[model samples]
Target: MTGIATSCATSPTQPSGVAIEAEKIRQELAALTALYEERNNQFFSHLHPLLEGSAFFKESVQHDFETFSEIKMNIKITRLEIRKEDVWTSVYWEGTWKVISDASPLLQSGQALFIFSAESPPRLMETRGESPFGVFQKAGTPAADVPISTRE
Candidate 1:
């Protein structure tokens, strides 16, 4: 079975495809978080090349940057898991976030769902549960989680 052996040898030895995808998404998230936390928009260009916009591009990416600047909130990804389907990959992610100027001394948790291409950069296709205030707000209702971060 030389042919079989050759094919096996040529194949990748990664543990799980989902894990790999999760890691890539993690990196991207980390970079974005750092930018917001640091409030440094000068480096925005670094993310421009990697941006893979889908139908929710404006609401998810563009508005996100704007919101980040408005509220000065920071994100820390706590967990991320990915599942692969026939034609798409779904990701569940949780993060600890807080406003830079808030009185809260500790971070709070928030989560979001994303569907991507399952390839490099993931090419974000869809997103759900993206709170503009970053999981922290006066009211704890899903609908009340407005897409605006209030500094006061």
Candidate 2:
């Protein structure tokens, strides 16, 4: 028997460098979450200018939002529900806004949605699943992976 037998097998070995990518993503997401919790208005307002630039602001959103109490009475997040995925999240929020604050306490309450990616340094904020006309969407269920159930 001058023949040789071959065994087909593979070896499992870890990569040389430890992967901190997941940790990094988590940290970034956490930071954004904290920012939303602490300085939500500032954080959100910054987005309009950064991504859309000055044009979208002056031509599109100008005279579109309200300001009161020395605060941009535009989009206010009342509640937030985070739906996390492998490398992204869907943020659903309840918001109250003053589109046109008249003599009376005219305030409209609604919802908002935001999709967050795991890319480095993050990406521009989006409101794809938000209402076109309504200032904000209902925080309870603003279209997310998880069912944003609410009570009566």
Candidate 3:
């Protein structure tokens, strides 16, 4: 009975490989998000390459963003979900985003793109369409839906 209770109370641990990979993905997600907090053009400049090679980055068309030049743009990811078409093709994501720029805070959202294709590599992905979360339009899309104040 005690053994059963312990097993039920605590979820079985995942294999070491899965644990490690999951952690790696978490770290990657964190790093991608951190790019937004970077000042001036640092964020866009540094994160561009990472955003270019993913199918999900449908919006990160090469010529779209020369720079992620913003005065004070910050976004916090609120949700993330993943789906895959096959072992080689999978989708990585985020659900919510919040922005704190200059001197105010606003709730916004965004999605990212990635490709695990070793030869092609993965990108941070980009976004499109109007957003309700805030002023972050991934890499290629417009920020019109997002307030300009937040864009800066």
Candidate 4:
């Protein structure tokens, strides 16, 4: 009788490159969102490095801090498009914002687009659409009442 030996090697599974990148972006956004909710001094420091020095963004953040005693944001990334260039990635996200002030908390939901830089850790380049920070600004303003002309 003859004896034969066989050996096999197996390695643990790892996430794909896209999955890793998506998770990284998600984490970065989540951390930034938490800072917004905290409304602490550290929020600006954390935000400055991530943003592409948009004065409007800074002002919006300041306005939000002044407008709400507490802000809670729940962000869900709906789509992520990645590229290799000056424009790294674009994230389409929907967020539910709950703002608390002297009055009862106001809840609103909206979607926005975030453009990131091509750096290793992507920095926010631009933001479009409805943003969580400006919910109260829009809410507080009264809407214009314009009449439409009808053709007989």
Candidate 5:
């Protein structure tokens, strides 16, 4: 982060640091897809040097390592927005993942917000996701720590 040179917002036509950072995240996702397929640890470098993904992220990775002999993932960025006043970025994305041993491939998608400090890596602040099976959100419980209503 410290190494990132500050760029002047000279023209609307020119890309800003936010754009460049988002692109870097895109590259990381692509690399992660390849790494997941290969079950390689080298993908670590591609992630934010310090990542604060949701509990689901940790669980999903652990589940993959424990349950799957082969795994594949694909992340697509549908849209991204970055705020200049703050170090936060919001991304809307979709993804598909499969457990090769399972009977069918699994598809999942989500929207996430990230916080990036000047010298530190970006952190995944929160996310809301849905899969073929259910929905997930990275957030606190409702008032009084009650579960959200499942009723329609």
Candidate 6:
């Protein structure tokens, strides 16, 4: 019994599968956000791997690059939950974007939900709510009103 107890104490507790997946997704998101702030060519390469060639993602990112001369995003994962085959994370983000033609930077902050597939090295499947990715179009459609569906 003492030997059993000692072995139990010495053995490290393994994290649950969900916890491990969540951490991987969290790290991926952190890297993605850092790349977004950098706004370099490497951001595109890093982004496509995380998103798995999402057309909507490509369009939104392209728009941001064309419209903004400078952009900065600070993101915090507020909550992580698993729903069916997807892992959904709620993110609180603050951002500043300077339009290429504008003199002042636009500052915004909001919460968004990011859904990722449950596969190993999970891919971002969709984004809802106020997207950290630039969802606001030059047409003046509000971010809240922008449809969340992936149009590809």
Model 3 spans > 4 angstroms off = 1-15, 39-104, 110-152
Using lDDT as the yardstick, the better of models 1 and 3 is 1
Query: Can you write out model 6's per-residue Cα lDDT over 9-116, one digit (the tens) per residue?
Result: 634577766677879988888877877766655555544244645666666776777777788888899999987777888999998888763677788888888887
lDDT per residue (tens digit) for residues 1-152 in model 4: 12232223222376667777787778777877888787765566544243525555565567777766777788788778877742333334333333444566656666666665556665555555665544444345311221111111
Task: Mark the regions of model 4 whose C-alpha exceeds 4 Å error after superposition.
Answer: 1-12, 46-52, 86-102, 138-152
Q: Please list the C-alpha lDDT of all candidates, in the order they appear.
A: 0.42, 0.34, 0.35, 0.57, 0.44, 0.72
lDDT of 5 by residue, 1-152 (tens): 53353343345677767676776556544565577566565544443333423334444444555544555444456556555522444445454444456566444455544343333344333333332111222231111212122112
Global Cα lDDT for candidate 4: 0.57
lDDT, candidate 3, 37-121, per-residue tens: 4322333332334344333332432222223332232333333333342012123333322232243433344442232212212
| Superposition error at 31 for model 4 (Å) | 0.4
lDDT of 2 by residue, 22-141 (tens): 444345545544444342434444342233343322222322323321112233333333334223233333333332335333333334444333345443344444422223233322
Which candidate model has the greater TM-score, 1 or 2?
1
Residue 6's lDDT within candidate 6 is 72
lDDT of 1 by residue, 1-152 (tens): 99889767634665466566667776665665566455455324333222332223333434434433233444444455555631122333333333344545333334455434455665444344553222332333222323222112
What is the lDDT for 80 in model 2? 35
**Candidate 5 regions off by >4 Å?**
1-18, 42-56, 84-103, 109-126, 130-152
RMSD of each: 8.5, 13.1, 9.3, 10.1, 10.1, 4.4
Off by over 4 Å in 6: 1-14, 40-57, 100-102, 140-142
Count steric clashes of candidate 1.
Answer: 0
TM-score of each: 0.41, 0.33, 0.36, 0.68, 0.47, 0.72
- Compared with the true structure, model 2 gives a TM-score of 0.33
